[model samples]
Each structure stands twice: as structure tokens, then as C-alpha cells.
Target: MSGARGAWWARIPEPVLDAVVVVVAVVDVLINLDDTSGPAWAMATLACAALIVRRRFPLPVFLLTLPASLMLDIVFAPFAALFTLSERSRDRRLLVTCALLFAVASATPWPLDDLSSHERAWTLVYFFYTLATAAAPVLLGQLVQARRDLARRLVEIEEAREHERLLHSQAVLARERAQLAREMHDVVSHQVSLIAVQAGALQVAAKDPDFREGARTIRSLSVDTLDELRHMVTLLRASGGRSTELTPQPTLADLHKLVTTSGIDAELTGELPPDVSSTAQRTIYRTVQEALTNVRKHAPGATATAHLWHDGDAFGVTVTNTPPARPSLPLPGSRQGLIGLKERAELLDGTFASGPTGDGGYEVRLRIPNRAG
Candidate 1:
């Protein structure tokens, strides 16, 4: 109900406001006036006209109303005009003006006839008290407005800061993903190119039966590796497209291809747990890939053993290889594959470690917690 009235009041025009304030002020003067035939009534009416622009020019309103209030006091009229003047012109600057007007007006003779000194002092006290009362509402309104504006500004700043942080994080993640894709492309492209070149040479040397058989095996491994690598690239592209591409994730089922491509003889040891799911399976596969790549590059003549063991809540994989007895040939490429695998495992709250064993063999170990736990 009050809201409806406020909405109605908002549609009132400036001209209407001028007419209303003048009417109210004139009514107030006439209601309390004992005699209404002098300069006091004229001054009061002029003061009402001056109040129409109080919001735009409060200082002028203060000046106009102060003198009018003094004139009203001189006419033996009630002192309500001074109180009304203070109500109309009480802001930060106008409060000081009002206090000054009160002090100056108190020094003059009262409109009351033959007043006692005590009665005069009481009237002066009443004037100051009225000025204080008028200042209370304006000061409280200003404080409430300042607090509400401050809270609104703080909320806006926090939302903007959070948006900036999200954008920065997305940019960093995009850069890292692009770098990883580039590295994978370089590694796969090099290995595939080598296999293709070697296969072409073997086809030419087919007359030499012994060399031909070895070349055929290399060719086969090369073809299979290329197919797998292409599938991986497709999967990356598709998943990166919509993130719902359900091209089957690699699992322990593909372990044989890894061994064959590495050109290493691996003796598998244990059974994979029934509960080993997508995440752990991928981690294991990548670990084997990295280990075998290192074996082919660094341990050329060494044999590797791939083992998987499941006991209770933890599952483990070990890839151990006897290193080349002779001086190590230059290891090909930057060896960041195992480092990346370790980081992947750690992100899933697993453990991974790889280094040379005391018995002149390289060993890579990984342990992942089972899902049932």
C-alpha cells in the first residue's frame, strides 16, 4: 500500500511540488497565526517559494528561510516558523547555518510580552534542541546510503576479480594442452618415419632371407604402431572437440601391442584386479609405453619384463630391464615421458618411481589405489 503511494508520488511534477509546498506552508502559518496582516505573512510565503529549489540550491534556501523566520518571530507570532525553516534547510552546510541562525535569533527580543530572564533562556534552549532534532534524520539517512553503496561496490569488485582469475586459468590450461599435443606429434612422427624408411629398405633386401624376416617383423610392428598412434590422435581430437566422445579408452587389453612395438621380449607375471578401471588402466599403459621407449632407445639389446600385481587395496606394475653391458649409447630424445607419467599418477594420488637398480638393471614401478577402497 505504501509502495503504491510512493509510486504515485514519483509521478508528481516539479510544478506540482511547488504548489503543494506553498499550500502546506500557508496553511501552517494561518492555522497558528493570531494576526495575519503584516510583513511576517509575506515573508513566510516568499520562504515557501524559495524552498521549491531546496535540493538544487540548499544554501539559498537556508538564507531565504532564516530571515523569514526572524521576521515571523518579530510579529508576536508562535515560533513554529523557525522550526519549519530548520526542517526545510537541514543538511551538512545547512545545519551549521541553522545553528548560527538560532544563536543570532536568540539574542533578539522575544515576541512574548514582558518575559522573564529564565523564560528567555528556556526559549533559547528549545531552539537549539529543535536544530539538533532536525539534523538527526538527515545525518542518519546519509550514513545508511553510504553503507549500502559501499556494500554494492564491494560485491561488484569481487565478481570482477573472480572472472579475471577464471580467464587466466583457462589460458594457462590451453597453453599446456597445446604443448603436450605438439610433443606427442613430434615423438610419434619420428618413430613412424623411421619404421617406414626401414621397411622400404627391407623390401629391397628381400633376397637375403635372414634380413628379410627381420625386416618383415619391423615392418609389421611399424604398421601396427602407426595405426595405434593415429587412433590416439583421433581420440585426442574428438575428445577435445566435445568432451563426450566415447571412443573406448585404452586398457590392459592393449599391453601386448606395446611389447611388440617396443621390440622387447616381455614375460608377463600377474593378473590385473577386476576393479582396475579406466584411469588406472591408462596410467599403466602409458607407464609401459614410456618404459619400453626408454628400453628401445637406451638399452637397445636389453630384455624387459612387464609385471602386474594386485593385492588388497593397492595394485602395482613393474617394468625392469637389464641395461646394455657396454658403454651407454647416446640416449635418444629428452627423457620426459617417465616424468610426465609420474605427474599423471601423482595427480590421481598414486605413486610412481623409476631409476637404475643396484644390479645394473633399470626399473620403473607404479602403485595405484583400487576403486573399492
Candidate 2:
């Protein structure tokens, strides 16, 4: 209940709070104006007015209230100023000095007159009493300041915890993706590869024309399916964004073998520089692999040509395929292969383009700077 009230009190506007403080100080000064002189009245008025700017100039405002404290038996003006000073000032020495000055000003007689030794002792006793009393506001102000600091620190610690939780969630998701990729590669891919190999053997051994043709179709579709599965597995394994490899990455050296096993009539021509980086070689291999797979699925009975060449400051591969001699079989596809290839090329500071040729053929091209990895 007290916390709620404090929060509501904090919501009050600064100017309104300042005005209320000034009015309270003025009332305190008026109550003690019974036998005070003109100078006392003037000092009291100045002190009340000075409260209006106490927050902006705490030390100076506290000094202005000292004269009224010395003459009039008023407590609000000086205490208010002292509290403001203590709340704002971080220097312990300055606060101690201010508190001592307030104590001396309040305890001393207005006129400097000769006093007996006993009277001087009594005055010394009054000064210590007032000094102890002045400590209340100072301690309260310091407590408030420490509370504000602790609140800010708590907010920062909460934000740090929230960020740590988000990172932990991402780490869990990456591990799950890695597990899924392993299942697809080890179980699903192996079974599909066996089916493709069996279909190829049957196509060669079968004597009936229709049976051989059906077996060839099965082998071609199986190969295409396996290619897509490999791309998906690669993406899932790399989802963690780490450099560690879970499988042997293909490079330009494997290009000939890829073409031979593609289940399509494809020819690889030309060659890249032998000094090409491993990353760039892998990119080239994937590009050619995806293009030939597209040809097999979208352009049945089409012959494809993959040509690698270097020109000026760039080097890349271009895969072009003749138009399909027969209608393509309907195949399931997520259609993200080309998008993935385009993204991969962009990562290497390269470009990818694919469209139909003027002769109704399809062409896909990838280009990367010679200096790119």
C-alpha cells in the first residue's frame, strides 16, 4: 500500500510539488513571526521564495535559508533545503559541512554580545543537540537516493536475463534441426538411393520395351527426389550457422561423377582455375547439381550442358538445357531450390539468373568474382 502511494506521489508534476513546498515553508515562517523584527521578516520571505528553485540549486538555496533559521524559530525552510541538498549531492564532506553550518546558524544568538563562561557552556550544549537533530533529513535523503539506484539496477538485470533466455531457446532449436537432418540423411536418403539403384538395374535387364521404359522413369524420379532431399538435409544441418561440417561437401572435382549419376543426358564442358577456394568450388557444384535436377524434373528427355569458364575478373558456370521432347511428369516440389541457390551466390558476392532461352530451352547462370571465396 505504501509503494502504491509513493508511485502516485511521484506522478505529481514538479512545479506543483515545488509550489506546495513553498506554501508550507511560508506557513512555518508566519507561525514564528510573533516578535521578529523587519530584517527577520525579510530573511524569512527570501527563504520561502528560495524553496521554489531548491531542486535546481540545492546548495545555494540551503545557504539562503540559513539567515531565516538564525533569526526566526522556523524549521520547514532550512530542513527542506537540507534534504534537497543531501538527495542531490554525492560528496560526503560537503553534506557534513552544510549540516554543521545549519546547526551553528540555528543555535547562535542574533547579536554578538559578551557572555558568561557558564552561558557559553550552555550554548555549546545547544549546538550539539541541534546538530544531532539535523541528521534526520540527511539520512532520509540518502536512503531515497539509494532506492532509486537499486531500482535502475534491477531493471537492467531483468533485461539481461530476458536476452539470455532468448539465446537458450535458439540453441535448443538448432539442436533439433541438426537431429532432423541426421534422420533424413541416415534413413530416408539411404532407402531412396537403394530404390534408384535397383530401378537402374531393372531398366537394363528387362526385355519388354514398356517395362524398361517404366523402370527408367522410376530411376529418374528417384534420383530427382534424392537430390532435393540432400539439399534439404544440408540446409537443416547448417541451420546452426556453424562452420563444422556433418557431411563431406561436394567440390568441382566431383562434377563429372555428379553429371554421370544425374539420370539425365548431361555433358560438363570447360573448367575452372585449379586454385579456386573450397567454398567457391562447393557453390559451383551445388549450382550445377540444382540446374541439372530442374532439367530432369521440368524438361523430360532434354539434354543439358554445364560449361565453366573465366572471363576478365570473374569466373562461373552456366547450365543450359534443350526443350523437353515429351511432357514432364507431375512432381512434388517446394520450389525453394533456386531461391536457396540465389541466396548462396549472394553470400559469396555473386549473382544467379535463370530463364527460358529464345529457342524454348532453359538456362541458369552463376557468376562470382575471381577473388571471392
Candidate 3:
């Protein structure tokens, strides 16, 4: 509650605060106005009024208040001015000098009459007392200044920490993108290479003219796809340092194009609900892609079907391929594609399974909760 009141007080206008200070100083002077001469009253009034501009000209206001301190018993005007000066000034020597001047002014006798030895000694003692009293405002002002400095420094430190967190997050994202590029080059490039080889062989062996033409088209598409993949890999690898255009991310809507250009006899069936998130759509698309690529690589001359289905609380895709009619190629395999797909499924709180079916065919399945959206 005190903190809230302090904040409310801080919101008060500066001019109004200065006016309040002046009024308080005048009241203090009036309270101590017993037996004061005309000149003393005039100086006290001057001191109180000078406080109106003490924030802008603290040293001048403090000097104006010294005469009043010397002639009258009032303290509020001079101490207020001294505190203002101390808070704003960084020069320690100047603050010490002003403090000493205030002590001398307030302790010395107003009239320039000769003082007796005892009176002079007592005046010296009073000077020390006044000097000690002056230190309170100066020290309080310095304390407030230090508190403000510490608050500002803490704000700057927090901003630096926030910026560091942002950089760290970006670095982590860049590393993930680089890793993704490596996976695409390793897995997708290998599948497209197999498609090119198969098309070339089919083109040479086929007797029908239309078969030869289709093989040529397939081979041409495979080469073009390899080129695009190479470009995409280059962009993804360089994304850490500079901006680069990336290929559009695949979604359910692009499943038809993916199945058509997959360089295999694959059929896509069924549809997911329209409310699925982009992340889920991309995950589903990648699942089918990897499943189809595996069938072309490991099950030659086989027909594959991708079925998308959703139950009350879950959705998924299953890709099933018949047994190969021809012997599989002796293609190298690292099995990283399936591992990546499994990891992707787990990240979305889903499951992935792939194994040979009872009919000597292979089936890959992915199932995710609807909340994965």
C-alpha cells in the first residue's frame, strides 16, 4: 500500500509539488517568526519563494536561503534547497562546500560585533552541530540517487537477458533447419535417384510407344525434382546467416501432387477434417511421403494405396503396398527416414508403426489424437 501511494504521489505534477514545498517552507518560517526584524522577515519570505524554481536552479535557491537561515530560526527552506542540490549534483567537492557554507551561515551571529572568548567558543561548538545536522539531507539525497541508478541498471540487465534468450532460440531453430536439410538430401534424393534409374530401364525395355513416352516424362520429372531438392537443401543450409526463399511447405491439399509425382503407382484416398492445424497437416503429408518412398525403394513393381481416416477422437493415415512383382534393387538404405517419421509422430503425441503384413506386403500407419491440431 505504501508503494502504491508512492506511485500515486509521483504522478502529481512537478509544478504543483514545487508549490506545495513553497507553502510548507512559508509556514515553517511563520512558525519561527517570533521577535524577527523586518530584514529577517524579508529574507525568510525570499527563501520560501525561491523554492518555486529550486529544482531547476538548486544552487542559486540554496544560496538565497542561506541569509534566511542566518537571520531566522527557520530550517525547512534551506534544508529543502540543500537536498535538491545534493540530489542533482554529482560533484562531491561542491556539495561539501555548500554544506560548510550553510553551517557557517546558520551558526554565526548576525551582527558583526566583537565576540567574547566564551561566546566565540560556544559559537564554534554550534558550528559543528549545524554541520552535522546539514549532513542528513545530503546523505538522504545521495541515497535516493543511488536507488534510482540501481533501478535503471536492473532494467538494462533484464533487457540484455531477454535479447540473449531470443538469440539462443534463433540459433536452436537454425540448427533444426540444417538438420532437416540433411535429412531431405539423404532420403528424398535417394528415392528420386531410384525413380530415374527405373524410368531409364523401363524406357529401354518397353515395346509400346506410349510406355516409352511416359517413362521419358517420368525420368525428366525425376531430374527436375532432384534439381529443386538440391536448391532447397542449399537454401536450408544457408538459412542461419541470411534470408533465403524456401519451397512451400506440404499440406493435405498438396497430397495429390505429391502422390502423382512420387514416381510410383500409388493411390490416395479419404480426407481429414478441415479444422486440422497446419502442423498436423504437414505431419500427415510427410508420413504419406515417407511411406510411399519406402514402397518404391523396397517393393519394386508394387501397387500402393494411402488411406486417410478419422475416428471420433483421432485421425491417421495408413499406406499399404502389395508384394513386389520383381526382385528389389540392391539400393543402400540407412533407415533414417522411418526414424525421423517416428520422432515426428511422438512429438505430436502420436504413434507410428510399420512392418510386413500377413499377406507378405508392407504397411505403414500413423495415428494422432485430434488434439494434435
lDDT of 3 by residue, 110-185 (tens): 8658999999999999999999999999998887666655554454445546755875787777778888898999
Candidate 1 residue runs with Cα over 4 Å from true position? 1-23, 73-115, 172-373
List the global CA lDDT of all models: 0.64, 0.86, 0.85
Best-matching candidate per lDDT: 2
TM-score-best of 1 and 3 = 3
Q: TM-score of predicted model 3?
A: 0.60
**Window of ten residues with lowest summed lDDT in model 3:** 240-249
Residue-wise C-alpha lDDT for candidate 2, range 1-373, written one tens digit per residue:
2353379778899999999999999999888788778999899999999999999999999999999999977889999999999888778899999899999998887765888899889889989988998999898888777666555445444554675587578777777888889999999999999999999999999999999999999999999999999999988887743433322467898999989977779999999888889999988998998899788667866899999999779999999999986444455679799999999899899999999999999999999998795
Candidate 2: list runs displaced more than 4 Å: 1-6, 241-373
Error of 1 at 124 (Å): 2.4
Give the TM-scores of the predictions, in the order they appear: 0.39, 0.61, 0.60
lDDT of 1 by residue, 1-373 (tens): 2333356655798778667766776666566566655776776777767666665665566566655556554311112233334344424575556555644553444353777889778777867765565455445544544444445445444554675587566556555554555566688757786887889697777898888888887888888887777777655554442222222356788887767755556666677876677778888888887787677556645789989987777887899999653233343466678779889788678899899999888999988877522
Local lDDT at 223 for model 1: 82
Cα miss at 372, model 2 (Å)? 21
TM-score for predicted model 2 compared with the true structure: 0.61
Residue pairs with backbone atoms closer than 3 Å in model 2 (clashes): none
